[model samples]
Target: MLAVLIPLVLLMSGLSAGVLLGTQLGGFPLLAALPTDRYVHAHAFFATRYDPFMPICFVGTVVGDIALAVLAPEAAASGFYIVGAVLALATVTISLVKNVPTNKWVQTLDPENLPEGPDYEGKRADWGRWNRNRSYLAVAALVANCAALAALAVLI
Candidate 1:
């Protein structure tokens, strides 16, 4: 079981971290710079692509980490897995609570007739902040996952 769970958790956590980091470093800045009309459309375009993929990766990572935490031979490895699970869970919670709703709200806008003001821009800023937070959490989870793997490797 460790054979399967170790690689599975690493793969899922790594993919989740990579995607979130890419969005933070590349995508968010571009979207933040766009005018409201362009931002709305661009956000909708980028947002839809990640729907099922990210959720699957994050959830899979969580489940794998939990399994690893329970099954690990070494107490340190199990602790690392527990930390990874918590961090991954935090990423999921933030995505559902903050980012998903923002994405949904962006999808509903007409773009052509968006209200004129700082309100919309503020929304974009808020979204970016939340994205950054989740990205950091995902990356932290990956690190914890790696540490868990390393601890197990040392035992062998």
Candidate 2:
């Protein structure tokens, strides 16, 4: 049971982390570069097109890994799983606390023109910073997950 679960989680979490890293590297820069209106509109456009499923996939896999960790039979193996889960969960927490509200604020602005009140550039900068941090966390979780899976593969 544990053997099946560990590898299954590895596949899911690894795929999610890989896609997230790519999207953050590839599309997020576009959001930072555009002017206010274009930035909002472009986010909407990209969210509708390129990102509709990615977030769901990422969250699902992270949650799946956590669940598997909770269910694992051995203490040492569970410790590695929990470490990966905590790192991945931190990324989720950051996304909810930082990214979502900032995104909501950005989306509400007029895409035809720069928004009034608060510094637009600063908001984008802060958002990008938060994203970078989350990306690093995701990378760490992915690495931890892979390591755990590899160890489990050898044991099982």
Candidate 3:
């Protein structure tokens, strides 16, 4: 069980990092560079692709961490998994509250409706910062989860 959980947790953490980075950094910049009509269509497509994946990754990290905490109480008693879970929660919260709203706003924009160049650049940059912050949190959680997994590995 411990062996299985460790790899699963790592896999989910890796995927969460990839998806978040791709959607925020990759997709946003790509959309920002395109012309208005293309931007709208691309942004909508990316969001549709992202929304389905994000929740599963987020929940998987949370559940995996919590399960680790429960199964290896001694390891979690040291607070590693707890800290990881907290970081993961922050990642989820920022994604839902900050990033998702920005994506929605971007979806509503038409090329005719937006100012040229720097206007969209500024908007994309603002949301990019949020994405970076979430990335940091996810990385931290990954570290914490890995630490707990390591501790469990040693114990077993």
Candidate 4:
């Protein structure tokens, strides 16, 4: 149990935080640099097509979380771990239910010919707010994972 839980917790924590950092340092900057009117739409569209990190991180977080729940009942059964897992799940859920669709909607807009109906700036603002919230979730997950790991270590 220790063998499995230990690595999984560490991995989930590390990867969660790492990806958050990447977004803060890389994705956010790139998005901010793009023109809000229509260039952002084209850039985001192409990025969704070419980017690999988001997919990898998403899969990793979901899989690691499920694994942690199964393998570490002590951790998963209550408190920080549960919060972490729930937040992790929420993070993915938001991405699926909100962000991906937003990106797809943006992508369909022509860089130079986007319809006036969709408020690009509003969308950008909403995305930014959600992304920040997601980052907070990631950070909380990382902390909770570490706490669980530490608890498990003390017991063992």
Best candidate (score: lDDT): 1
Q: How high a TM-score does candidate 1 get?
A: 0.97
Off by over 4 Å in 4: 45-63, 66-78
| TM-score of structure candidate 2 | 0.81
Q: Candidate 1: where is the Cα deviation over 4 Å?
A: 116-118
Q: Least accurate stretch of 10 residues (summed lDDT) in model 3?
A: 111-120
Please write out the lDDT profile of model 3 over residues 30-114, one tens digit for every residue: 7667875676667666766766677887788888877777777474534787787788889999988987887788777775566
- Model 1 local distance difference test score: 0.93
Q: Write the per-residue lDDT of candidate 1 for residues 34-138, one digit (tens) a residue.
A: 988999999999999987999999999999999999999999999999999999999999999999999999998888888656488788999999999999999
Looking at model 4, which ten-residue stretch has the lowest summed lDDT? 73-82
What TM-score against the true fold does each predicted structure earn? 0.97, 0.81, 0.78, 0.77
Write the residue-wise lDDT of candidate 4 on 1-156 in tens digits: 647665755675677677766777777667866787545664565546525655565556556655665666474333556666777777777777777787777767767676667677778777767777877877777777777666666656
**All candidates in order of TM-score, best leading:** 1, 2, 3, 4
lDDT of all predictions: 0.93, 0.72, 0.75, 0.67
Give the Cα-based TM-score of candidate 3 against the true structure: 0.78
Q: What is the clash count for each candidate, in the order shown?
A: 0, 1, 0, 0
Task: For model 2, give the 10-residue run with minimal summed lDDT.
Answer: 46-55
Clashing residue pairs in candidate 4, if any? none
Top-scoring candidate (TM-score):
1
58: Cα error in model 2, Å: 4.3
